[model samples]
Target: MGRLYQVTVVGFKGERVTVDLCNTEEQMSSMTVEQLKTKVVAKLKINTELSRISLIFADERLDDDSKLLKDYGVQHMSVVQLVLQVDGGRQL
Candidate 1:
């Protein structure tokens, strides 16, 4: 077992979820951004596509699915904001 990290995911309509993630640098680096988005959608019961979901931390938006969590500097007790991407390009 690896060290557990508490990640707070804030989504639309103020919906939030706290997820436990592995803190090992190697493990975190192996996980892709898409996997995290899927977990958030499943927890929030949101019927949204993975491509339309955006994860943000420290005011920086994570846009690459191929990037790892460690690449984004996600660590223990990190707060991530989840936003739904709309087609109109409107700011949320």
Candidate 2:
């Protein structure tokens, strides 16, 4: 079994959830950002597509879906911000 870490995911509307994640250095290093996004989507019950969302941590935006979380310095008890990408060119 891998080590478990506590994580808090906060949504744009201030909705937040605390979840326990089992992540190992090896596992996370091998996982890509897209995979992480999928995991977050499942945990947060997000209704939007993966392309319409982004994860932010420590005031930094996570953009590379091909990189590992460790590369982004994501650690235990980290708080990740979930933001919905909006197309400004589109009329509401």
Candidate 3:
């Protein structure tokens, strides 16, 4: 069977956007959050440190080791938000 997941993309410098991805059961069950993070980074061309970013899988904080559709609690066709923390470009 195929699974549909809503992937939300957000960054400190850009507006939030959501994308949908379809994956097979095998693919969905085997992909880790870190792997998904890499995909997001690649698709978005994020050059900054990924450690500074927060990925909310289905509105919950995603564990780096958690799998996209297996370990993470995301509903079918649900939205997953990726947020990056920024300090408004000001130095303290």
TM-scores, one per candidate: 0.84, 0.79, 0.62
Give the poorly placed runs of model 3, Cα more than 4 Å off.
1-6, 10-23, 66-68, 86-92
lDDT tens digits, residue span 3-87, model 3 = 6655666644565655544467566567677766676777777786766566775467885645555677654454566676667
All candidates' lDDT scores? 0.80, 0.76, 0.62
lDDT of 1 by residue, 1-92 (tens): 67776679987778777976566757766877887887788888889689888899888888998888878987767899988888898645
Q: What is the lDDT of residue 78 in candidate 2?
A: 80
Candidate 3: residue 71 Cα off by (Å): 1.4
Clashing pairs in 2: none
- At residue 53, candidate 2 shows an lDDT of 82
**Cα miss at 74, model 1 (Å)?**
0.7
- Give per-residue lDDT, candidate 3, residue 3: 61
Measured on C-alpha atoms, candidate 3 has an lDDT of: 0.62
Q: Report the lDDT of model 2 for residue 5.
A: 58
Per residue, candidate 2 scores C-alpha lDDT tens digits across 1-92 of 77865568887788888755556756655656677688788888878888888889888888998877777888667888988887884311
